[model samples]
Target: MTKILGISAFYHDSAAAIIIDGKIIAAAQEERFSRKKHDPKYPYNAIEFVLNFAKVKLSEIDHIVFFEKPFLKFERILETYVAMAPRGFLQFSKAMPSWLREKLFQKKMLFNLLKKNDINFNEISKISFSEHHLSHAASAFFPSPFEEAIVLTADGVGEWATTTVAVGKKNSLKIKKEIHFPHSLGLLYSAFTYYTGFKVNSGEYKLMGLAPYGDPKYIDLIQKNLIHIKDDGSFRLNQDYFNYTTGLSMTNKKFHNLFGQNPRDSKKDKITQFHMDIASSIQKVTEDIMIKICRSLRKEFNIPNLCLAGGVALNCVANGKILKEKIFENIWIQPAAGDAGGSLGAALAFWYLELNKDREVTNKDRMNGSYLGPSFGNEEIKNKLNNLGAKFEILEEDVLIEKTADDLSKGNAVGWFQGRMEFGPRALGGRSILGDPRSSIMQKNLNLKVKYRESFRPFAPSILRDNVNDWFELNEDSPYMLLVANIKKEKQKQMTEDEKKLFGIEKLNIKRSEIPAVTHVDYSARIQTVSSDTNKKYYDLIKKFKDKTNCPVIVNTSFNVRGEPIVNTPEDAFNCFMGTELDNLVIGNCYLIKKYQNPALKKDYTKNFELD
Candidate 1:
């Protein structure tokens, strides 16, 4: 009956996770409830939700774990500033106030925050802190299917380690090696994200998405000037070209001079050929480093199974490269690989690593498909829709699936909200906007009309587990939608030389595969293989769609407009449905046709969220 609560906050993607006797009870991010993207405040809302969901009070919790040791992190920051002295004064001064006022005494602040939530001040003394990378490692390996595996975590920075290699066997994990801060691949990628006119942290994916549009023309220049890599994947940055350690911006004047241009002003600049090339170059470097690291790990440990966490692990493109290289026979990644997942990891680290509990492993993973967030019953949904004066119909599961499949086959975009919400960045069919993947116009239509995002941005596909290998080059399970793979050659459309010569984004509209909506310009698709064991309802709906259209894949994007967090409740889904060009909304067993809904319910959803 041991109940443990894990918290990660103050550094972005704040979240809370609870585990009962080593079983993950619930986990969620603050942004979903607060409606703030990457909310870094204390995860009070998320913590409260998990407690209620698990039907436990704070006093019942035997342990509470914070994701990282704040003092250790502060020490690292202080030492780095001292080492860089005189040179890092501005950044040091800018960071000191927060460190001194809040982070330096984070334990006291945490206790007060908990007391405000009605937890007894005495109970707060049970809290402990886990090292940052250890949390990442625990999150990756604990819920993974493997009983033994090599775990790799890479991020911008933790207390001191930015990257760590650990081995997990049964309930225990041992750190093998670590690469400390100021030498980080995650920061390297983020720096390019900044240089390419995209927001750091949030915009790293945009850079990865933009890579397919250009050649890796800057790879040599990047290797020679920006980063130095050895054969084993460990590398150092030429700090002369970077400012993240000492200034507000990621790149310095030396970097700008080397790149032959200043940073692109996101507000005024068009994504030019140069920007795309830079994106491509960095992506290539990232993939190369990841592959090299996996190769090194494989040769060193020869472990068939590998698990990954940390922010960089969210790079599906690099993950895809690791899979393609076959350095590891199997890879299991935490769906919430970013800081949000640290909460879960921290809790698990306490349960197994600290308490010495026996490990329980599962071939299907212990994440329960990462559907560990809030859900609404049909009665609640019906009431919400009825109160909104929205026109709707209700059906049983089978009929709803049939109707939704029929609508999808007819080229209608469906907002699918079912069961518990997902706990990570991906929608995973739980809170997804779906469309016909085979439609040549589906990509553009979903991007411009539905998501209101850039046309160049690609969508992902959720394929039935049985049909995944038939359509994609991947044969393994990818239930979490964290891996990218090429569309099978049989489904690809041959292109003419003139079509191939189309420069930059001109090639976007040229369909390269039958499932053009999900296929990127490079013929790769971010693949999510849905299994009935994890989510029977979603699996059945896709199964029905496949039976109707004979296409095994569907365009699966998050159930929100471009910049908004994924819809967390029935109300959020209903509002998004009314505001977007979606044809239908399906929540639990309730189905609503947009045309029948009150026209007045349609407000400008675009104005609801600020674009990232």
Candidate 2:
């Protein structure tokens, strides 16, 4: 069997993946293992996990690919500095030392790092590189259910390209167009993310979550001063109002002046109506740009299938809009659509494109529901729980599901850890905190007492695949929790005129739907369709929930506090359970209720991790 190993490191969300004969074996991110949010160090632990899971030594790997070519990235940095010379020397000087010492020679540094995994791994020639956008495109297309697709990838600058369009047919994928750095849609969203007092990469989702609370009042001003877009969705950023080209910050004083305020000091400032309005404006602009691009591409290529990747693809609202507009007959997005996914994309690109191998398409796509991380057997979980002095009872599969369903029906927040962990930013039932979606206070309690996050941030609904259409406006597969759709009008609770007049957070408390916890302020829900074919246990649990309450939906959020990476092991789950306000813990067939556990085990979890 031919084995390929892929690595994406030195950038945020470092990860590793292994493929055997072009079939993905295992994939995981460094943050999960390191317990650090967006860890950018070499994915030593992730690499080791994939290698171990695949049951192969690093030396046995036929080819090893890094996600992006360092030389090309270095060239872009140098060229960007030269073009903006004298004006950005401070940023240039600070960056050059690291580039010269480490990043410029990534292959050599990677070689040394690989040796830590296996001392016998000494073959340097096995190392290769894939372009960033190419990797993103490959990640979206290769494992997709489509045989041929128009691939669109947009993210912060990768080498030179910021936005790319690629065509993929069978085993062949080629880049057709590129909009290079300093003119990025991803950076534009991130600029708003920064200006709104949120962390850049980590906080973009928060900004997206806050968008529905306010009006998009600044779209005209944004279009006039910041970006110039054509009818075809091609656009350019007016860099005079930005600083990301050659500075540490994402926006400049001109950008602040255009908005009539300095960047909000996140530590001190409360999120006001202005922040919500700004979020709404940027989100609308982003949706418009993405829709325009999808429409233009569908017209230009006449392809029925569209595949999306990169950081921007994580914008579920935009994905939902593209779907709602019927721009493509079928759409598939990479579950791990950020830099972490680049590792798998790099490996797959080398397998299909580099090796010129034959392609095979599956009706259900080859991601295996994106549950590609580590899992523990019941015995292992029991042993770990015993070692931690945790109190628990092991039950039969039927009993466990029944008990958990009963807990949900009673409005208890349950820490549900089972099977393999998810590879993406989302917690797909596998590593999730679940609650009764019908509970009106579930969202507020989970955010403040459990997640220790902003109250306005929304939770997603994990609905049975068969029941998705009945409850939500969507009729498509959204197994990755990557599509937003409105709750069915019949299930929605209409707001009064006075309620509608309330602005920002004031509107958060009004229940909008039967599944109030998962529904957003605008009645939309980020939906994850659970299928028994992919995740039998999770599906079975939800089925039992449905049997009990006649509702197939549950509030599912990542199994961690805000700023913390999703739990990776039984120990991590236990610690988080003790730390948060979760009412019960379920791992494997084990169950532990909060009141029965040792009081000393309770933790001050709110201050456990730094805010994302």
Candidate 3:
């Protein structure tokens, strides 16, 4: 069997993944261990995790694939700088040193970093590069549950191409069309993200989250002045108004002049109707373009399923729109859906395209429920608890499941740590903080006390797979929690007149769903349904919970504090438990009750304590 290792680093969200044969073995992002949001440094921690997960030595790795072609990206940089020459002298000066010292010789630097990190199995013999967009496409297509799929990948410029359309069948894939660099939907959205008092790459989700609070009052102005849209839905950024292509700022003086404003400061909190309107307008425009692109892709390939990846696919709002449009019967999106997941795509491409391995197509292909990370066994858990000198109890298989379910029903936030931590951004029960859905105060409690995140950011729900259709509009299982569908109308709560008038984040208080804490203001929720076939332990817990409480759904958020990566190790989970107000943390058979945790643990966790 061929063993392929994919590495994406030196950019945002450096990550590593190992694929054995045609199935994914393990994948993890560097940020989890580094504790830096979007740590673009070497994925040494992530690489080690995946290697240990698969129990393979570096020598056993047959091939190592890196996402993006560094030389091509460097060429784009040089050309862009020359075109914008004197206009961005300061930005250009700052960009050059990093380019010359690191990015310019990315391949050699990558090989050396691997060696420094104990991966000294001669990378030169196995290393390969796929075009940036090709990696994105492969990421979308290879794991999808389709014999053939029309694939769409759009993101900030990679090498040169920013967006591309492709068709994948069996082991063969072909790019049908590409939108080259300097023109990107991602950069466009990022420009607005920068303008609206948010960090560019990091704050795109914040912008999307903020849009629902505002009306699309600036859409006409945005279309007429900021960007020019064609009949095909692809548009050009009015270069006169934006500077992101070659300047440090996302927008130019003309952009501020037109909008009658300056870029909002990151920490400033002067959000008004105008800012909200701008966010709404840009969001509408983005959804429109995505739908049009999907329609065109359907016309081009005549395929029923569409595969989406890149940073853009993380837009659940847009994903919902495409689902409503029904251009394709099904869509399989990458859960990581960012620069990190490119590692999986890159490795899969090597296995299928280069190694000529045959692939098997299922109703959901071979993602294995995206649960491909390191998992500790009973002995490891016992050792950790003993080392910490903490009190704990070991329960039998049935007792563990029943006890966890009982805790959830009693309104306790339980950290449900099980086999193989998930690779993608979503928690997916393995490394999940679960709570009862029926509690009206659960959302606020978790947001304010446990997660210490923005009160506006909503939590997701994990339901038993069988009962998903009973309460959600989605008929199929959403194991990845990427799709947001409306809660069943029968299950929706009727709003009062005052609640009807309540717009924006204030609307979050209304019970729009049967499980209010997991629902958003719009009566829609990101859903992940547990199935016995995928994760029997997690499923059985929920099954027992449902039998007792008559509610199959539970709040399932990733196990970590806000702005932190999900917990990857037992220590990380324990530390997170101490840091937050979670009632309990369950890893393997060991359960650490918050009321009984060590005072030494509580001392270190006091740094970011909050309670709702």
Candidate 4:
């Protein structure tokens, strides 16, 4: 029963993960439970959930690993504030109290929290801290199906390094070069995200999504005014026009004046073409910088495979561009590329570096397909269905697959809850909203009817693993949906002159693929391939759907609507189904009919008594 617990807290996207004898048992982000976008408070709630889910006492844990060394990160923070003295005075002043109480005293904080959980730090034996990018590197590489590969991690700032290049072989990883902080590609994207009237960390994806709608009108502006790139693939920011260090925003008044407007305040103004163009320009800049860095990393490492992590790796747009160029023979991205994935990385680093465990790189990546969250057993699900007074059927395995496939083909959006929940941001089939993408109106229907999300947001395609190359331009695997790929020539729908002339986000209605709902305005799709080897249930269901409909892909989105985190428990899943227009929800073997759901018998539905 040897087990290790890895934790990432205080920093945003706080999470906890448990690995029992080298197998990932449980992992989840705090945001799912807390309902915060990036809950950064110590992952007390998440840790409790993981410990209870694994049914292990804290005393049974062999080791505890923190994601990043506190002192090292504190040093970076201090040095940065000192170097850019008085520039970020207001923010610095606001942050000082928290730093003193939380950051500087983290070791004591960790000790107290662990002690409170009845885990004797003395008997717990080993405790260690991983370098930030090292954790990111380990998270991507150790789980990848590669004996050796080039590793690249890029984020806003981790300690001093914003980006790092390394070579990972078997159980060992060696850092080759690191591009330090304040010159981060991520911050550049965030700065523009803020400038374009979107939240910094949360809004980067919106920018990426908006890129297809507008022209890259500010690419030259960003290149010339915002950043300075050297030949060595390192770049520096012209801090004068930025305010992240001191001011409330990533962009300053001068930056706004240069752009001919102040930052668009989201609470006040409507999103316009100007904002879209800015998002487009910044996203293109990010992709360009990433390509440049990838080229340099390839030349330096000369490895055929690449492992990508850090928060920016979640940018499916950039991941797609990198794939199109074929710089790396293969790529594997961390499903939780943000701070939450850091927990898994830190745990693996402890396993290999501290425990000195032997590593195995298999033909399939050692991720268990990222289904590391808590799952409902048949008993638990059946009890909930009975309690809710819902009519349901417990079908046999083959029957379940066939019926689910038939429902999907008929355009019923089913909440496919099976196995453990997913650990990452994306719902990788288990906690997913499933629909037939071949329906031309399915995208809008899912947006306005099923999921009740933004109309502009696109759904991701879950294709059978073997059919990746036939439908997409990609020859590589994307089991995590962290990478985007172009629709194959044969899969694309013919465009009329009217469709070609469609401008702005209105172009979203243009058909690009046999499955138009998942295809983006740019003719690319964030594709997740299902493999029976990893998740047999999801794989079999997709296979059955393809057998029935002859389409290898289906629409897969998180099982929750916009502004809410993905459903974390059976109750959450059921409540979301009842609130939204979801046609069906399967929990374990019990299929719940939302139409027959009785609200009074349930604890509560959050959507009730609320006006949108």
* Maximum-TM-score candidate: 2
Best by lDDT: 2
Q: How big is the positional error of residue 439 in model 4, measured in Å on the Cα after superposition?
A: 1.4
Candidate 4 lDDT, tens digit per residue, 557-611? 9887766778887877877787777888888887766666675644434453221
lDDT for each residue of candidate 1 in 1-612, tens digit (9 for 90 to 100): 999999999999999999999999999999999988888999999989999999988767889899999999999988989888889898899899999998989888888898766655466578899999999999999999999999999999999999999999999999999998899999999999999888888999899999999999999999998999999999999999999888889999999899899999989999998998999999999999989888999999988999999999999999988999888989999999999999999999999988999997767799999999999899999998888787788998889999999999999999999999999899998999999999999999999999998888989999999999999999989988889999999999977999988977888889899998899999999999999989999899899999998988889999999888899988889999989999999998899998888788889988988888
Model 2 per-residue lDDT tens digits across residues 271-349: 9999999999999999999999999999999999999999999999999999999989999999999999999999999
* Number of the candidate with higher lDDT, 2 or 4: 2
CA lDDT for candidate 2: 0.95
Q: What residue pairs clash in candidate 4, if any at all? A: 88-245, 88-246
Across residues 213-269, which tens digit of lDDT does each residue of candidate 3 receive? Answer: 788888888888877777666667778888876677888898998889998875656
lDDT of each: 0.92, 0.95, 0.83, 0.83
Alpha-carbon error at 42 in model 3, in Å? 1.2
Residue pair clashes in candidate 3: none
What TM-score, over all chains together, does every model reach? 0.99, 0.99, 0.95, 0.95
Lowest lDDT block of 10, candidate 2: 600-609
Native-to-model Cα distance after best TM-score fit, residue 337 in candidate 1, in Å: 0.4
Q: For model 1, which pairs clash?
A: none
